[model samples]
Target: MSNDFYTSSILPYAAIIIKICRAYTNTQEDFEDYYQEVCLQIWRSNENFRGQSEWSTWIYRLTLNVCLTLLKKNSKHHVTSNHLPDVVAEDNRTFDDESLNHLYNAIKQLSEVDRAVILLYLEEKTYQEIAEIIGTNPNNIGVRVKRIKERLKKILDGKVN
Candidate 1:
């Protein structure tokens, strides 16, 4: 992707990209990789935008799909090796609120679809918009969102693993 196109198409939506990438990744290295991959995929798929949906909506869908795909692939290739050095962040930054950190950790426990749903909900997307992005019935989004909230509460309360 050229610097000009990336600056025009992606930099404007960097926040959305960062939030989605953060939700899907555990470590800084993984986060950087996912962020790069998402940008690349968005650039590659730019030509496919048919204008049926708003640009933000298209970017959201593409971001979620790419994250989910990479997550599934990583899970299948689960590799553990003590010989590998541990990754450490060069910048030492921490969340100010423990509860917020816990909340995010809880959110990470959700199923991929539920995670996407909750993220969209947190972003204040309409149920219809979420359903359109997630390929679900609009009416079902409310029920799912309610259930997802309950699940998250349980996760935060140590009632669910």
Candidate 2:
């Protein structure tokens, strides 16, 4: 994509990128690294976009794939982060809401695929849209989402780990 297209996409898509990357990362440093890597992948794959879906949907798939890829790669070399998880947004101004932080923390506890499902569901993507992005059947999303929501509730309520 052209510089202008990427630039414009970055601003509008910043929240999606941040939330997805943040969910997969445990520290501020790792979050920043994931964010940069996701953006880099977008830049590298500029020519591969086939316009078969909306730009936002395409971006969602790209962000999720990049994060998932990096997440798996890190597992082979996993090291505990020195930084505290709640301390992640201390220096960042955008996601400072207390409840948002709690929700994100709870989200981080979910299985990776469940995290992606809930993130897309929260974005208000239709079941079909989410299914397309995640390569699952549309009907499966509804059932998974229902389950994920219940799991998130239990996590938030301090009843489950």
Candidate 3:
């Protein structure tokens, strides 16, 4: 894509970029840094975009890879427990705004891969789409979503909190 196309067609989805950045960072400075980095990566890779998928899809995958690489290079403080149980107890549902905050917090408590899966799921991306972006099979994405949802419930129920 040309510079004009990128600025005009892709830059308009700034909110999507910000949301992706927020998923990858915990602070304003970190968020800004990741956001800028993702933008730069997108710009640098624009020439490699082969148009096999929707522009948004390509951007999403590229942005996620960029964030994952950066997170890998940084500290390991955000790594979620790998052995968290897949089963969760019932009767702990919180559907209010507090529930939303709890959801975000629980998301932060997940591992980087789990975080990416849950974030994309919460964003309402389909399993096939998520699989494409994450370079996994759709069936694997479905299974991971189920496991992550249970994990999130466990986190919200004070099991991991």
Give the top-scoring candidate (TM-score).
Answer: 2
Candidate 3: residue 25 Cα off by (Å): 1.1
Estimate every model's Cα lDDT from 0 to 1: 0.81, 0.84, 0.75
C-alpha positional error of residue 157 in candidate 1 after TM-score superposition, expressed in Å: 1.5
Instruction: Write model 2 residue lDDT over 48-140, tens digit each, in one string.
Output: 999999988999999999999998899879764422355553443336587887787778778889999999989999999999999989989
- All candidates in order of lDDT, best leading: 2, 1, 3
- lDDT winner, 2 or 3: 2
- Give TM-scores for every candidate, taking all chains together and pairing residue i with residue i: 0.87, 0.88, 0.79
Candidate topping lDDT: 2
Per residue, candidate 3 scores C-alpha lDDT tens digits across 1-161 of 47786687568877667766766666567778998898888878788989999888888888888888887777565554433333321122223466664576567677877888887887799999998888889989988999999988887888864
Candidate 1 regions exceeding 4 Å error are: 79-95
lDDT of 1: 0.81
Model 2: lDDT equals 0.84
Model 3 quality (TM-score): 0.79
Cα RMSD to the true fold for all candidates: 4.5, 3.1, 6.5
How many clashes does the backbone of model 3 have?
A: 0
Model 1 earns a TM-score of 0.87
